[model samples]
Target: MSKFLLSALFGAAVALSSSAFAADQTLAEFHADMGGCESCHADGASASADGAFEFEQCQSCHGSLAEMDDKHKAHDGMMMCQDCHVTHEMNVGQKPTCDACHDDGRQ
Candidate 1:
């Protein structure tokens, strides 16, 4: 009985380790498959209904770009738009400063 319990424990550990490794491998492959923002963001072919600029289509490559602060401010909740569309050149990969958008309070 003791031997059986030990074997089961070891088997469980091995299974867990294998699962973790598989997950890591998948993440690595995903990272490897990722391309630069310009790969899709640029060109008139990528334009959407929300104007010629958008980033929702970029979640697969760029992930999330929202921010939270001590004031409990969260852009994710307030705006469905991406920062690159309203503030900077999405394909150029240049991030704009806060003042760029907040200057006129239009953002």
Candidate 2:
């Protein structure tokens, strides 16, 4: 291939990759759009002290672990937020249901 054609292809590839990266928002962005950082951070300035926003942190706002346990007791509470909300972007309808992770035989 000509040098010019090769350069064009490389440029296009870079642009596509960068756009994909940009599409994923940062944690701070999610906090701003959703609510005050304290909702998840506990103390925004000292987040590390509290803990990184993992499944437990998400549970604070979405629902209590106990609530989930009660609701999903039949399924043995074998689901996690990540199973549905694949990314922090968290769009509705993008999430999967119990059936997605559980077997068809599950009650």
Candidate 1 structure lDDT: 0.43
Instruction: Indicate the TM-score of model 2.
Output: 0.37
- Pairs that collide in candidate 1 are none
TM-score of each: 0.34, 0.37
Query: Which window of 10 residues has the lowest lDDT sum in candidate 2?
Result: 87-96
Query: Please, what's the RMSD in Å of model 1?
Result: 14.1
Q: Estimate, for each residue in 5-62, the C-alpha lDDT of model 2 and write its tens digit.
A: 4575577558656764333465445444445565455555444442436456666544
RMSD to native, candidate 2: 15.4
Cα lDDT tens digits, model 1, 8-55, are: 557755765676433323322322234333434555244456632445
Model 1, stretches more than 4 Å misplaced? 1-46, 51-54, 66-73, 80-93, 103-107
Give the range where candidate 1 is weakest over 10 consecutive residues by summed lDDT. Answer: 24-33
The best candidate in terms of TM-score: 2
